[model samples]
Target: MQPFDAKPLSDGDEQLLAALLDGMEAGLCAFDRDGVITHWNSEAVRILGWSADDAVGRRGFSGWAARTADAHDVQTRLLGAMDAPGRQVHEFALLTKDGHRVLVRTQSAAVQGQDGRPAGVYCAFSEVHAQIDLERSIALSEALFDDASWGVVLIDADLRPAVVNAHAARLLRTGRDTLLGRPLGDLLEQGLEELETALQHVLAEGSPPVPSELWLSLRGDESAKRHCWRSGFVRLGSPLGEEPVPLGVGWLFLDVTEAKLAEQEGSLLRFRHNQLHRAGRTASECEDPVEAATTYLDFALAGFADHALVDLAGDDGRLVRAASTPEGSSGPCLPVPVGTIPVAYGAAHPVLQAVERIGTVRASFGALAAAEPASRARIDEWAAARRWPEGTVHGLSTVLRSRGRTLGAVTFLRGAGRRLFDRSDAAYAEDVAVRVAAALDLAQQLG
Candidate 1:
C-alpha cells in the first residue's frame, strides 16, 4: 500500500490537499494573521451560499458575511485563536450570499508556520442546530448504556455480543467483560438457534417492523422454566459509506416473564374450570356412578396431565387400583374387575404419602437437565421401577375424601416433556379428586 504523504506538492500534493479538504463532512476555511481569508472549501461555500472565488481574499466578514456592528467583535474573537494555546470555540450569526442570516458554531485554531510560530487561523464550523443534534445523539447513547432499566446490547455482525450495557449484564447474570465475544449458545440453554436466526435476518434484510417475543432458558439457572422477553431490534449501518454497510444489530429487550406467566396461569385456570363444569354436565347422564367417576378423570386429563389412576381403600386396609387411564393414552379411564388384586405400592410412594398425610403429595423426576442418551436410559429405568407408564417424570397425588371418610387416592401423572406440577396444579387436581370421590361414594351406597 502507498502512504498518503509519499508525494510532495510539486508531484500533485497540492491537488491531493484540496481534494481532502473538499471531501470533509464539515465546512473548512483558513485566514492569514492579518484576518484575510486565504482558503475556503466547497462545504464552506455551500454553508454560506458564497463561491470560493467570492469568499477567498475577503479581508474578514465585515459588510458581506456579517452585520457591520457584530463583524468587529466576531473578527477579534476569531483571529484571537492565532495567539490562543489551543482550539477556541465560538457561535456567530453570519449572512449568506442571499442576505439570509445563519447562526453557526465554529472551532478555530492557530496554524503554525515553518518557524514554529502562529501564522494564521483555520476554522471549521457547522449550523448550530446540526451541532446540537450531534450532541443529543451522544448523550442518548451514554444514558442508554448507563442508566436504562431494560437490557441493551450491541451484537456484532458475527452474532456475538460486542458491547453489553450494565442492565444487560445484570440480566445475563454476568459482568460486561465476561459476556463480550461469547457465543449465544454458551449463554442460552435453549432458544439460541431462534435468536441467532433473528440476528442473521437483520444483517441480511434489515430489522423487522414488529417486535418479537422469545422464550429463553438462560444457562445460569436450572430451577426456572423458560423466561419470556419482549424484544426490539435495530440494524446498525455505517453512515460514512456511500452504500450502507452493515455494522451490527442493536438488541433491546424487557423481561416480561412475570407478566407472561400470569397470563398463562389465567388462561389455564379458565380452561380447567371450564373442563370441570363440562365434566359435571356429562357425568350426570351416566347410569353407573363408577363410569361417572372415570369420566371426570378423562375430562381432567385434557390439559392437566398425561395419565391418572384411582386406587380405592379396601376393607382389608389394602389399596386396589379400581380405575386407570388406558395404557396408550387419550382414552377414558376403565374400571378393573371387582376381585382385582391390590396395587403393589411400597410404603413411601407418593400415593401412599397422600393417603398417610390426607393431603396432596408432589414429586419430581429427579433427572438431570439436558438429558443425554445415557441419562435418558437411566430415566426410563427409573420410571419402570416406579411402575408408572413409560415416560412419567412428574406426579401429583391427592387424597380422596367423601364426607368425613378418606375413601382412596387419585394421582395425576405427567410425561418427561411436561413441567413439574406446581401448587396451582395440585389445587386443580384436588378439585377433580373431590368430584371423583363423590361419585365413588354414591356407587358404594348404591351397591
Candidate 2:
C-alpha cells in the first residue's frame, strides 16, 4: 500500500517499499540510531514472525534475532558493526515470521540523512545462502549419473520417465523423445527382458540396487539374441533442490558382448595353442622329430579339421608325409604318394598355398580348384565317398617356411560349417605355420 523509491525514505515510499519487501520471499528491515527496529517488511514478518507494528523501535539484536546452528555469530557480528560505520555492509539473520530459524545473508549499512548525520541502519535479507551449501551435493549426484560407464535412466517418484542419458538411449535403441515421460515398465518391454527383471528387483527390494547381466531380445529379430548388456541400479536423490531422499532409481546398462566374445575366443586359442606347445615339448623331450610332427598334426586337426598331415617338402614339388593319424599315411615321397592322396576341395587348401607362398593364405574350395585340377578331383572324390556336402570341406595349407625358404607344409582339412575361421583364427594358424617352419629348419640342421 506504499510507493517504491530510492534512499532517504518518504512515508509513502517507505510504506510501499515495505509492502514490496513483504511480498518478496527474502526478508528486509531497518534499524534506527539505537540499533532498534524502525522498519520491517512482510517477508520479515513471515520469516521472523514479527509484525512491523510490534517490531518498530524494538532492539534489533535483542528483540528480533534469527540464527542457525551453522552460523551462530552472523547476526551478532552484523549488529556489532553499527559502531564502526566504516564497514558499509554486513550480513546476518533475523528471527523468521515463524519461530523456525533459517540461513540468510543480510546487507546492512548505516542510514545517513542529507546533512550527513547517521539516522539509522538498513538491512535486506536473502535466503540464497543455503543454495551455496548444496552445490557440492548437487555436483556429486550429477557425477553419479553422467560419469557412469553404463547406460543410466532415472525414473521419478511417480514412476514416470524423468531422464535417460545417451548411453541408455543407445542401449534401448530409442530416441530421448520416445523414452521420456513413458513408464519404465513400458520401455523395458520394448528394450530387454533383462531390463524389466532388473526394474522389478529394484521396486521389490526397496534397498540399494544391484548389478546384473542381461541378454536382450527387444528387436524380436534374428539379431535379438545378440543384444546383451550388463546393468546396475541404485536409488538416488531427487534432482530438485529439495532435501534429498531416494525419490527415484537409476539404471545403468553396459554392452558386454564384445568382452564376452573376446574372452571365449581367447580361451579357445589358448587351449589349442597350449596343446601345440605341449606336444612340441613332449617330442623334444623324447628327441623324436617324427613323434613331434605327429603330435603337431593332431593338435592342428583339433582346430576345425578332422584330419591333418604333417609332411616334409620333397624336391619334386610334393610332400613327404612323415606321420598321419589313422595310420598307413602315404605320400609321393613315401610308399603312398602325397600327390595321389585325396583332399577335399577348399577344405583348408590355404594351408598348402600358405606353405607354397611361404606366408599365410586363406582359400575356399574354389581357390584350391583354381590351384590344380588333379588336387580338385582328389577333393571331389573324397567328398563323394564321405556322403558329405562338397562345400563342407575346405583345405587350408600353411608352408613351413623359415628364413624365406619353404621347409615344408603343415596342412589341415576342416569339415564344413562347424566353425568358420575368422581373421584371428587365421592369424593363429599363421603363427603355427611359422613355428612349424622353425621346427623343420631345426630338423634339417640336426640331420
Candidate 3:
C-alpha cells in the first residue's frame, strides 16, 4: 500500500536491476487482479517466446496455451495462491515456444491493493536444466582439481580463498578445509616480491583477468622451498541484488621447478661444450702451427679456463708442451716433458691419434677410453717408443710428427678429481679434437 515513485532510477540501479534479472537465470512475470500481464522479463520471453505485446491485454493461459498445457495448471495455482495466505512455490513441466518440454521451478506471491486485498500475482520461474548441469559441472570441476598435475585455487575479491583444489592444498602443504576463506596473501606468509607483483597484476586487469607466472615460497612447512606457477583470474557472482563486484582471482598453477633446473644445467653444459667446439674450429681456420695451436687454445679456454697448454711435437719426436699460458703461468714449462705434466685435456688426446693415423681431423675421449685395450696399447707404445720419462703418458689426441710432419694426438687428463664425463660431455671433447686436427692439416699444407 506504499505510494509508487515515478522518479527515474540511477543508471547504476538500472544496470543492477538488469544484472539481477540476468543473474536470476529465471523467467519472471507479473499479472494484475484481472489476470492481465503487466510485466514480463527476457527470461520469460526466452522460455515462452511470448512477450508483453502478446500477453499484456490478453489472458495468460490462452496466449501461452500453444507453449504448454501446464499453463492452465500454473494459472490454477496462481488463482488459488491469491485467495490463500502467504507465498508459495511449485514445480511443473513447461513447454517452450519451440515445442520443447522442460522442468520449471515456479514461485508466486500476492501483490496487495490499497485495502490490503489481493490485487495481483507476481510469479518467477527457473528452468531446472541447471540442476543437473550444475551437478555435472561441480563433479567435473572437482575432478579437474583432483586430477590436475598443477595447483589450482579460487579466491574472493579480498584475495581470500573461496576454494583451494586438492593439488593447490597439497602444494601449500595444508588441508583444503583449513585454508578455505583465508586471505591468500596471508597464506603465502612470505615476503615474496614476485608473488605480490603477480597477484597485483591479476587484480589490476579487471574482468577476464590475464594469466601470469610467479614464484612462491611457502612457509610453516616441514621445510621451506620455492615453487613456480602460472595463474589467472575469473569473476564470480555476489548474491542476488548486489552489483557484480571485482571478485578474487583463479590461479591455474604449474610446477616448473624441475624444468627451470634442467634449463640452467643444460645452459652450463652447452657453454663448456661450445668452448671446445669453437676452439677446434679456430684451429682449422689458422694454418700456422703456432697460430693454429694458439688459436685452438684460445677457443678452448674462451675466457673459461684458468690456464692452457698446447704441446707440439718436438724435433726429438717427443710430444712436448710447446705452447703455455698467455697469462704467463709457470706450468707447462718447455722441455718439462709432456709425459709428466698433466691437466684435463678432455677427448683431445684420442682425437689427435685419429687425425694422425687417418690423415684427417679426428676426435675421441682419450682419457675416457684409457681402459680400452686399443687405447692402452696406443698410449703405451707411443710413450715407450719415445723412451720418455716414466710418468709421461701419451695424450689421447696427440699431434705426432714424423719428418717435420705434425700428426695430431691429444692427452686429456681430468683436472684435479678426474671426473667421469658423460656421453654429451665426451662428444663435446671429440668435436674440439676434430677442429684441432683440421687446423694441424691446414698448418702443414700452408708450411
lDDT of 2 by residue, 188-266 (tens): 4335445555565566565443566665644424332455577677766655556556676776678898897788788
lDDT of 1 by residue, 1-447 (tens): 112213335547777888898997778888888888888889888899998898888889999999999999999999999888899999999999999999999999998876677778889999999999999999999999999998999999989999889998988888999999989888887777888999999999999999999888888676645778889999999998899889999999989999998999999999999999999999999999999999999999998889898899999877888888876665778898876588888668899899999999998775443232236677677667766787777888999999999998998888776777889999999999999999999999998
Model 1, residue 372: what's the lDDT? Answer: 24
lDDT of 3 by residue, 1-447 (tens): 111222466778777766666455778777777676666678777777766466555566644533445677667787666887777888777666665667777788887776778878878877777556876989978786788776778776666677778888877878989988766655664445665555555666554345665666675543445565666655555555456555666666777778876786799678877766666566456546556655655555442333433555545544445444433332321212336443333443443444446432322224434333245456555544433222223222334334455554543432211223445444554555455555555555676
Question: How well does each candidate superpose onto the true structure, as a TM-score?
Answer: 0.94, 0.47, 0.47
State the lDDT at 278 in candidate 1.
Answer: 98
The candidate that wins on TM-score is: 1
Query: C-alpha displacement of 279 in model 3, angstroms?
Result: 2.3
Model 1 bad stretches (over 4 Å): 1-8, 220-225, 367-377
Candidate with the greatest lDDT versus the true structure:
1
Return the candidate ranking by TM-score, descending: 1, 3, 2
- lDDT computed for candidate 3: 0.57
lDDT of each: 0.87, 0.59, 0.57
Q: Relative to the unseen true structure, what is the C-alpha lDDT of residue 263 in candidate 1, on a scale of 0 to 100?
A: 97
RMSD of 2: 12.2
